[model samples]
Target: MDADLVECRACPRLVAWREKVAIEKRASFANDRYWGRPVPGFGPADASLLIVGLAPAAHGANRTGRMFTGDRSGDFLYAALHAVGLANQPTATRIDDGLELRGTRITSPVHCAPPANKPTTEERDNCRHWLDTELELLKPTLRSVIVLGGFGWQALLPVLAGAGWMIPRPRPKFGHGAHVRLTGTTTIDLYGCFHVSQQNTFTGRLTPLMLESVLASAGRTAGLLP
Candidate 1:
């Protein structure tokens, strides 16, 4: 699955943009070699808690081949995770940075980096199947999900519904700290958080404590914490 995922070119615009960024290179990271392909989820496959964000950052994951690495947004997120004891380190600059996640995983709704950090609805839907496949594989242990933005929140509900979880009519709204539990043979707790994008963190819309609080809640719910 990992091999097939990295080679996906289902979206032509995304294909061109991710590859173009890899070749042109960010001036500050001119020495860096870019992943320039679909970035996969990171952490143990048996992770009990999942953090879902938007697409990979242009120079961040797209360059490092790992989700949330080499970016300020990741710095904000990992710091929170470390404070809450889910991550061994508060920094992720490279794929092999000695970072580790404990009973948790990070992923994105869209795998490839999109132009201007925005993917069209078509592009988002085009990437949905990969998430579906991932969820199927995660069903045994994925008890909770932390969605990082409205885009990911909107994209995820349908996927969860399609997987046999009963989504309430009119659907749950997105907001920081919003929590919804879906019923199926097994239940899932869905959490909403503001994206850790520079726009949010820089403006203080999402403080480190706020993120840590939610993560702690999810971790306990997933039985990853006391």
Candidate 2:
């Protein structure tokens, strides 16, 4: 999928709101042009473990054109991935920072930057097709997925369920190390740490150790590490 297409401003409401944010925050990101548009998936194209996040932060991935880059969330996420040996670096401050993934891929359910971090159901539904396509193109090798939150799990579950797999009842609720195995081949492990926003990290809601532990468990489950 082309990054530019994902960054599209087809939705009038989203376009207007994004433009406003760009105008208001012009000085901070003066050289940091807002992707002010949809963000595309990034990471190893042939990864086996897929990590799904909620959506792009207006000034974060939505601006940097890389999943989880340019934000506190990416900071925490990349640190964990690096700690687990799935990433080559410990920090991601820009889209072109040359960071690389070894065994994992990160993406969001909603490709576009939604206003206020909330995407309408219709918008989410529309984006699911892209998600489905991406999954299909990834092709038959994914062994596990790590969904970051309840909303992400909800968006992705139906697709997995439709593929002749059984999802757990009470739905395998989200929490650190929460996992569900489907069809004896693919496993969906959900780790529900608070999103690594400035609010959460600054408040100490999710510490580095906590996030690293989750990634460690995910690595073991996915057989990416011992």
Candidate 3:
């Protein structure tokens, strides 16, 4: 499934943009080879906790080929995860940077980096099936999910409902530290956190302590911590 997901080009606009940025190359990453294809979720298959972000960064994951890698957003996220005992290390500069998630996984609704970090509704819908399939495969062991930002929160609710969980009508609102109970064959808890984007982090909107608190709470909820 991962092999097939990597070759996806279903969204023309996303395809063009990801590939274009790859070839042009950022000045800082000119010597680095870009993983311009759809970046797959990273972490163990049986992860009990999942972190869903909006999408890969144009020059970040699109360049390093790993979710949240080579970007300030990733720097903020990994450090928090490490602090909360959910990651082996805090640095995520590259795919081979030796960073490891513990009983947790990171993924995005739209795998490809969208232009200007925004994916059209159509593009977001086009990429739904990948996440749909991923949820089914992870359902057995998955216990909690932390959705970052409104885009990811909006995108994930329906997918969770379709994957056999009961999402209440009017839907759950998205807010930092918001949480909801999702009932299915197995109960799963869903959490909302502000995206660890540079805009949020640098502005003091989402601080290190804020992120670590959420992670630690989610990890304990998922039974990943005592």
Candidate 4:
């Protein structure tokens, strides 16, 4: 499934933008080879925790080919996950960086990198099937999800509902620390967290302690940790 997902060119705009960035190359990483394709989710298949992020950064994941890699957002996120014992390392510089997530899988609503870091509504809908399939595969062991930002929170609702998780009417609002439980053949809890974007972290809108609190709470809820 992952091999097939990386080859998708379902959204022309995203394809162009990602390829353009790959060709132009950020000055800092000018000499490095860019992955320039859809970034696939990373982690063990039996993970109990799922993290849904918005999308790959144009120069980050699009370049490194790993979700949140080589970006400030990933630095903040991995550090928090490490502090909570979910990740083995506090860095996700590249795909083979020896950083491993113990009981969590990280994915995004849209697999492709988008222009200006935002995907169009159509692009999101087109990419929904990937998340849907992922959730179906993860449903057995997945106990909790940490959705980063409102985009991921909104994108995941219908997918989870489609997977037979009973979503509440009107839906739960998105906010840091907001949580909702969906019960079905398998029960899963969803928790919202501010995205680890520079806009949030640099502005002090999402501090380390705040991220750790949410991750720790979710980890405990999922039984990843005592």
TM-score of 4: 0.99
lDDT values for all models: 0.93, 0.74, 0.94, 0.94
- For 91-140, candidate 1 gives per-residue lDDT tens digits of 99999999999999898889999999999999999999988988888888
**Model 4 worst lDDT window (10 residues):** 181-190
**Could you tell me how far off, in angstroms, the CA of residue 172 lies in candidate 4 after the best superposition?**
0.7
Model 4: residue 192 alpha-carbon error in angstroms = 0.6
Clash totals, every prediction? 0, 1, 0, 0
Per-residue lDDT of candidate 4, residues 39-115 (tens digit): 99999888999999999999899999999999999999999999999999899899889999988999999999999
Which candidate number has the best lDDT? 3
Model 1, C-alpha of 67: deviation from truth (Å): 0.5
Which residue segments of model 2 deviate by more than 4 Å? 3-10, 23-26, 184-193
TM-score of 3: 0.99
Give a tens-digit lDDT track for model 3, residues 129-179. 999999999999999999999999999999999999999888889999999
Instruction: Indicate the TM-score of model 1.
Output: 0.98
Pairs of residues clashing in candidate 1: none
Evaluate model 1: give its lDDT.
Answer: 0.93
- Residue ranges of candidate 3 with Cα displaced over 4 Å: none
lDDT per residue as tens, model 2, 66-167: 788887788888998898898999999887788988778888788766787888887787778777877765546676677777678788887666654577
